[model samples]
Target chain A: MSTPTETETPSETETEGGTRLSYETRDRLYHLALYGSAALFSAVILFPIYWMVQNAFTDSQTVITEFSWLPSPETVTLDNFSVLAAGAVPRYVINTIVVTAGTIVVVVGVSLVAGYGMARFRFRYKESFAQFLLLGYMFSPIVLGLPLYLIWSEIGLLNAQIGLVIALSSISMPFAVWLMWKYIQTIPESMEESAWIAGASRWRTFWDVVVPQTKPAIVACALFAFAIAWNDFTFAQILLPSQESTTFAPGIMRLIDQGGYTSWGDIMAVSLLMTVPPLLFAYFLQEYLLKGFEVRTR
Target chain B: MTVHIDNMTRVFDSPNADRIVAVDELSLTIEDGEFLTLVGPSGCGKTTTLRCVAGLDTPTAGTIRVDDRDVTELPPQQRDVALLFQDIALYPHMSVRKNMEYGLKIAGVPEDERREHVAEAAALLQIGDQLDKMPASLSGGQQQRVALGRSLVRDPSVFLFDEPMSDLDAKLKRELRPVVQRITDEIGCPVLYVTHDQEEAMTMSDRIAIMDDGELQQAGSPKEVYSEPINDFVGEFIGQPAMEFFDAHVESANGTAAVSMGDHTVSLPATADELEGYVDSPVRVGVRPQQIGIGDPAEGIEAEHVLDEPLGDETHSIFETEFGDVTVVTHADFDGDGDTEYGLVLDESATQLFDPDSGVRIH
Candidate 1:
């Protein structure tokens, strides 16, 4: 809502000295550059999702024959969404929900406590242990999946939904704990000490004071764990081979393999559906998630 | 209600450095209803001593007793002491009322009783209307009142304030000082307040315990410490403009004693008997700014005027003398732009002598 001011006349200001700019002019130019890059980056990132939505609503014949920026309304139909009502797609979604919920519960609870201890307490090898957590997080999931498959097969945990849940949690938990630890560090320690002096035991103080202050971090950690478990393909593919335990990420591929044919419309529809929960999570909880990442000092 | 800190010591050790003795072997006692301000410079261990009494920091060697019971090893909750932090540590998520009720709730006080305690404390602190508001919704002073109300509800046997008003502005500090004093007086508990401001110690405390370098320098009433300081550190630390000192030599001959500085000398009074030991030896002569006066140019010790600081009711005039710079406080106005030379009249009877080597009072 800014009107054009004297600084908006770049030529007049630049005439004084070609390299020297007025403060307002310089600030406007910087913002224009920043927003230009952001728009370009967002377009690049969002194009695939936009194309998937476009193709999902179009008939498979038209989608295959035409390359268009916008879908024609005449070809749009609800027939592509029939995958949601039938086949392994529904079962895959149910399995994903159970695994995602379990991962969230395990990750949020454990990381909350571990993060509190890491931020507040001092013990032997504390720094080393913290570094070790980051080190564990750096390994690719494929590196863990192969070794973990051998162990799961030995224990008969293979092809179980619980095995997938456990695998996903281990993959996501280290970074979640690191996020929580850094977030909790921003909270003042005196807030906890005040509770301790108020006759609350250490556990009671942690619950009454620290937990309430960490709500944003809790939400953010839950979302993080959910995204990891929901979108995970490697661990789910390796551990849960049965269709009953297979989640959407790898289960949708089974359709192409079933009859030596690819239903591009059905595939696009399923891919769009797969992106919903995470998109909803990002849209609804973006405030708390942003706050969780902000390292505000008090 | 009395708190006894006996030979308490706290030592911190780390791998990269030598051990830090935060609080040396120090002993002190706070009688019931006494408002004792632990006043000192930074890194002087005043806060450490207060923390030990509150059971926040464990003393490495000595025992602390509260109300005739040894509470040295007890945690802060079991010690029955309420501490007001300088940071005003209020629970940000809770309303003022909930903040006050937290201690009682943890102690298993029933809902009705907890509400009553919270209500009473809220009314007492004039924060009754703010009970339902979050701490962030209130002003800084109001937030601090909520913090005070939180401690007031507990009614602990000992009250500890760690520079509570240090964050407030000058006007706010002056307003809150009497409020804190009146509340502590009504509670009749041993209150140990810590601050580095000497003026705060003088105005608010019934007695002051001055500390330096992890050791107790002196502990007495403000009047007593200001007038009869045991050492040069206390003399220099207690006053606003600070007491000035000059190098002088004691000259004792035939039952009379006098101290000479540069070319001027002042005869000692009946207390000259103490100067016999310091005869023909160097000493530090300490005098308050108020004790010296601007004299005639040819009468007293010759000096050159440096600057004049007008402090409302009085002016502090700094002058360069043969020994060093001396400050003379007077009620008369002096122009800083004029008058570069003057003589300083030393008040003979008011001057105190100290050993130059140890900075300890000689008489």
Candidate 2:
């Protein structure tokens, strides 16, 4: 299927005129090139993921001795997963879920109202305020971490899941607000005016009308906030140094840094476990992500 | 239900430009059950005035009173008015039933009563079967009906239509204009419609208020504004083919008034006797195209025929007269050859005389 047949090159005159090649041969070649490149890119991207899964299934003894690309069925074992289920991995997973969920709730709530105000209301220094928000988004978390830690410690929130949640929300808030403001601006002002003329108060209009209309953007913002808080290692490591309070990302790093080469399978198994929730969440919410990009009125 | 706008003004200040006075000291009264239309060219402050009435745009000064209650300081939700936007601003996410019932729900009407009101309004609009459908699924005309239904269910004290029919096709617009009129009539509420289309203003409004540069030009019935315009702008802004103006000198001799232009002089009617004091002064004579009559070549002022535009029922003959270019709308059966000369007579009763400098009507 990769090589062109003899009949495929029968269109020299058509090619010279800049017209299309013969239908059957052209279709075959075009599809072959498109699908071949697609498969190649998929393999390139998915190979690391496949390797992680293979390492997670292999026994610790086999992983230490063999360097084969494929895992043999006889050597595949559930010992690494059993160790993870029985260890602190469960507690770390719960901590990650709590921090990520809290971060998403706070980020989505505050940013939605702030974004709506920025997009709809006319205020003094509006442009300057928006620029200030963009600056917050542009600044790296590393730059803001020391001050945040000091403030959390002063407030007696250090080493607490709520403290981690608040820190993650602050990092994700500006991006969430920027996304929401851009989305809400696409809604015509007439829709709000219509609600107003329908006898709805401002609060009712915001909740009943603007909220429902911006559902897709809200879902996308939630997913983004989730990803930010779920994958954060730096903030969790700095703010939560206690062994029992840390999230999965820093916990996995701590396990890998224990200086033992025979525990590779356990590390791979935990990493694979950490990737599952986000993949499932994104897969289920792919529809809303697509809809978020469509900002037309009707 | 009377809407009294007292010396209302709206000024908008842009970041990059000076303040724009959108509605300047505009005052009007819409009586109960009367349909008044604000008509003008684009950027003429008609929509601004309508928005002010709807409480969508706040006025810089003055007060708006509906049924003797001053609502200028109130928000749109507090004012008992329904505004049908130009885009037919239906809540796209809601079903038709939900859209119509929203206002009632917000007003704290009982559920059963809300359902009844929605049903009644939907039936009135003939959209009962489409209640469950979303606005995106409906056609343009259907969407317009749904918008009207939403407003109708509110039973507002006033209805503000912001060119709601402008988005529909010509046939649909024609079909829906009377439906709008009938609904407003049934509701017996004052309606203030805004549109830049003169024809819609003339056909749909009980009284038309013409505006230009954020100032009211004139407010009168369509016939009064068309036949006896207060100024040159009103004269030119109304009617098809437009009114034509000729720069002429007013001459009063032998106890009679006449206007002289170039080599021709046409006698003015007795109603123009007010111009006697201004005899021999330059004045602008206005005449509608339909008011000009073609006569025998030997009888009246001579004009050379330039072209003929044959409409279905009448043919408008463009002639090169001493008045520059004049259009005469004659019956369809009337025949005249292009390039030939003919005599023209102005309908003395329809002739409008204006001060040449100020463009204000003399009588």
Local accuracy of candidate 1 as per-residue lDDT tens digits, B181-207: 877886789999999999999998899
So what's the TM-score on candidate 2?
0.91
Error of 2 at B253 (Å): 5.3
Instruction: Provide the lDDT at B337 for model 1.
Output: 38
Report the lDDT tens digits of candidate 2 across residue range A117-199: 98999899988877787687666787787888898889988899999998898778878898889888988889999999888
Give every collision pair in model 2.
none
Whole-model alpha-carbon lDDT for candidate 2: 0.87
Please give, as one word, the docking class of candidate 2: medium
The TM-score leader among the candidates is: 1
Clash pairs, model 1 backbone: none
lDDT of candidate model 1 versus the reference? 0.86
lDDT score of residue B253 within candidate 2? 41
- Per-candidate iRMSD: 1.6, 1.0
- Candidate 1 residue A4 Cα shift, in angstroms, is 8.1
Off by over 4 Å in 2: A1-40, A259-262, A291-297, B253-256, B293-311, B315-345
